[model samples]
Target: MSPQPQAAVGAPLSRVDGRLKVTGKADYTADHDVRGAVHAVVVGSRVALGRITALDIRAALAQPGVLRVISHLDAPRLAYRDNPGAFMDPPVGERLRVFQDDRVRFCGQPVAVVVARTLEAARHAAHLVRVSYRAERPSTDLTAPDLPVNDPLPPQDYERGTPKEALAAAEVRLEAVYRLARVHHNAMEPHATIARWDGDRLIVWDKTQWVQGTQNELAAVFGIPPDSVRVISPFVGGAFGNAARVWPHSTIAALAARVTGLPVKLVLTREQLYHGVGYRPAYTYTLRLGSDRRGRLAGMVHGIRAETSAYEHFLEGTVTPGRMLYATPHVGQTYRTVPLDVNTPTYMRGPGYATAAFAVESALDELAHELGIDPIEMRLRNETAQDPSNGLPFSTRRLRECLRVGAGAFHWDRRAPAPRATRDGDWLIGTGVAVGCYDTLRLGAQARVRLDADGTALVESASSDMGPGTYTSMTQLAADALGLNMRKVTFRLGDSLMPGSPPHAGSLTMASVGSAVQDGCDRLRRQAIGLAVGDEGSPLYGAEDDDVVVLGGRLRVRGNPARTETYERLLARNHRTHLEVLGSFTPPSEPERSSMYAFGATFAEVAVDARLGMVRVRRMLGVYDAGRIISPKLAESQALGAMVGGIGQALLEHTVTDHRDGRIVNANLTDYLVPVNADVPDLRAIYLDGGADLDAAPIGVKGLGEVVAVGVAPAVANAVFHATGRRVRDLPITVEALL
Candidate 1:
């Protein structure tokens, strides 16, 4: 069939839901006004690891307006049926069970809950609840000398060739150890859940990336039918990856409501959020690279370690870049998850690729310096045509274009080759570049579309909008497919009763859910056109179906503009109410025919004060090769926002923990630092404008949210090295290290 004229797909339209958000009408999780809802405060264990020896809740129960105090001694035993975990769950161990035992596995583990008539009453009573513990020295440090080390799972270790022997035979070798500090999500809106029960059925308004996942997990925890639970989350302030998993606070809210026979609301305090949610785990990466005099990579060896909780093993795609990013004859890697007395880590914005890029990209920069070659030229020399891990052709690999375009845009020719040569009044200036990539993840999704006789449409799926503008992008696709004005369509999401959708993370929402919406809208439009052509009284009767086009809810023949009929007249004459279709998309289950990934290049300019040891970024630019840009405005938002986050990862963000008691020292915003308006300088994003890769998905979009943040840190780090001639192997390139 002939494609419809492009109208809204590529347009740079503002968010469809922007008016509601700015006027304080958007309903986030905490904004839901459930009737008869009382506040519940969670009481956390003070010690990192211990066994509860004494229970004390009399003081909490006696506080004014406090209805009840629930703890392990009195809380009911949940069924906790075997839940075949969600997409983000680690396959190794079970999730943390809340209030089911006396053993404490980590600091700030929920020990008790205080439910009261008001939030103030709950807070006061929770502080009065106390317990005694028989504590032991906790293993919280990943590199402590006395801490026992647990080898990583066998499946994580990988090798392609004889890397050690090849490294020994190389003409030049480089080795470096890099460290990254753990960081929290710290979204604007705190994690919250409001749960209530009605005749053995549960209802919750939660801050979750996937409402269906929350519904399934809650049903499994209570041993009830999955259909009996309903989850609603219309708007999410921001999650990054913290809300991807079903955390303990969600279960605790439902439990409180069930025990007290009242709707219960729970919101974690800022300090509690540090220990309650997951974070980007600290990493120790030791890399060894062997290269020739001409900067050709021969072999590489990687030693990686990350911290996870003792109860569970969490892993990510940390070693994928080493296996496929460049051309190499031999590669070996060992990934180990160190068991520590801390909460398990989860995926942050960039996840594994961001961590690996710092080590790999920085090593490549060092090799370029030694070989007296430009960094971009060195990377281009080792670019791979096929994935080395599987020997499969790439659906689309645009790293070369990204690097080339970025070089010209960032003015690479003006950069001085020597370090500490370019200096201002009190600062040294330099520029650096690095390449970034992320896997184009695909998953199954479903969407429902309905075209009413009134010429308006409604499209819905259980997707979410966590600051990426899913509502606006999906609406754009639907409007273009249905050939209707953008103002005539409505898009709704974030409810479990809608059609199923994948989680909002992984950068797959646009590729998966957007495709489903397009399919459904196209089908619905075809139904309308077919109806009009079949009716004997219609002006478009007997017209060639393929030649018919829709614009402004009117069906007309392509060559004959006079043959036209509005949808309202045709549907009213035929006595039809509406046309409805359910669109679904499922990725191939067989082995992938081609490797699919989104690529980008990051360039940064920085200035450093050698006397006071201060580093400041002056400007940054990112060039991305993500497949198609459905909404140019939203795409710019994702790219520019991620660059800011990358700045934080390089210079300011760190989750400080006191290992002695397993306490997080800098948990609040006042102590923890993020990039402020004053800290951010000039920033820009450029897309390669390469059309589409149908092999990746139906909508022809490779994911962008994660890849845009991948190489940001190393670019800044390399710039600091060029500016001051000091190489700091750790993240947040601290002032003390520079001095």
Candidate 2:
């Protein structure tokens, strides 16, 4: 069959919803206008690791506009049925059931909720609700030597061959410890949920990336059927893996509505977000990598530990990259989750791969230096077309291309090889490079398409756009597949009532949801063509269905453009109101023959102040071999944002915990440092043209969001080391570390 003629795919088109967002017409969770909605504010515990001995809310109840104060003392018992989703999944022990008990697991744990007619009254009443806690020392310090080590569940911890013996016998050996600090999501829109219950049915206007996950969780908690609950989140300001789960505040909002017989809105304050939602857990990773003098890897051993909640285990794909990234004969990895008195962690943008890359990529850079090899050349030396971990052929591995393209684009050859060799005024300048990779993960998803007789189409799925341009991309896919104009195609998401979709995460939406949209549109177009051809009254009725092509509301014979009929005319004659179909994409049942992954190379130039111990990233560039480009403009934006996030992880972002009380010292944006407008400068992203991972999906697109961030932090860190000749294994390479 001939390749589909592309009209919209890969175009640098502007976002279809850009006007709605800029004009303030888009409705986010808290922006939803609900009638007679009351406000709810949670009162958090003051002390860490304690139980509420006594609670007092008389003053709060007496406050004006305050309807009721619900606490563990008088709160209704909820079923809190188990939801074992891997994304910040509930604890194996009892999940943090709202108001189910008086136990406090950490500071900022909700002790009570004050509901009122107005947000002001709710805020005032929440402050008035007093609490007394029986405090105890919290084990919040993850860096402590005595923290218990539990095996990193299955598939995460792996061993092959005699890694220890191989390392000991290797020609060159290098071992280093890398530390990463806890970091909050700090999405632009704080997690908000507005919930209402009527008889047995419930409705929620919330900010969530996974509407299905939230719907199921709410259904289980209320002991209602999944169909009884509806979740609508059509727009999200930005959620970098923070809004994927139904957090405690969402439950609190629903519970308050159930108790008061009125709709309740719960918007977590900036401070409340520190604990109310999920975060990237701090990790201590020790890597012992052994390679030959030519930089060919002999073996590697990874000893890793990351924080988790005391009640639940939180895991990410942190250790897999170390085993699969290189061609090594003997590879061994041991990962442990050190449960701490903290909120259970969830996926961040790049999630585990970013953390692992910081360690693995930086260590590789160190090994390159030790072996007197260029960093890019060193990585090239150990490149593998087959996954060393599972012995599967790679569907697409372009690390070498990324390295070569990025080096040329970033002018890598001009840099001096030695540390601190280049200088600008008082600034020590250096350049560094690293490789990033992420598996192209696609999940089953479905989309509903309806082509109306009026020459318009609507396609929908229960997905979300966390500033990744989902709306634009899906519209492009539908437009191309259905041969409709961009204006005639409307793609909707973030609604549980729409067709089922997997969570909008792990950079899976494009491949999973896009495939469904394409399928749906193809069927709808074919159906319309079939109707026109079957109708003897219609023009060109005898033409073969295969020869017909729909473009811009006109169905025409591909071989003869003159033979055509408008969709309106064809439908009017057939007496059909619309053509509708539900399209679905499911993962293949058999094991994949090849391991699919997206690859990218990041290069960084940094300048460090000699006396003040300050570091500034001068410029950065990333070249990627992501499969197919859906929308060039949006793809670039995604890449740039992920790179910015990587910069924050490498230089500034850190969630400081007062381990003495399990309190996050920098809970709000003001205190917590992230890369702001001034911090991001001269960043560029380039994509390899027309490359597609054949095994990933029909779209042939490997996900881009995660891989863009995977190697960024290490690239910056490597540059810092080259600039100052000081290797700081710990993340957010602080000024103190430089000194």
Measured by lDDT, the strongest candidate is 1
- Each model's C-alpha lDDT? 0.90, 0.89
Off by over 4 Å in 2: 1-3, 85-91, 151-156
Counting clashing residue pairs in each candidate, in order, gives: 0, 0
Question: Cα lDDT of model 2 overall?
Answer: 0.89
Deviation (Å) of 209 in candidate 1 = 0.4
140: Cα error in model 1, Å: 0.7
Please, what are the lDDT tens digits per residue for candidate 1 over residues 1-739?
Answer: 5688779988999999999999999999989999999999999999999999887889889988999888888889998887774545553676888989999999999999999999999999999987999998898988786554555456578898999998999999999999999978889999999999998999999999999989989999999998999999999999999898888999999999999999999999999889888999999999999999999999999999988888888888899998999999899999988889998889998899999999999999999998999889999999999999999999999889999999999999899999898999999998888888999987889999988889889999999999999999999999889988899899999999999998999999999999899889889888888888889999999987898989887888998999998888988899878889998888889998999999999999999996998889999999999999898888888988988998899999998888899988888999999989987989999988965878899888998999999999999999998898888889878889899
lDDT of 2 by residue, 334-393 (tens): 888987888778889888999999999999999998998999899999999899888999
Q: lDDT (0-100) at residue 630 of candidate 1?
A: 90
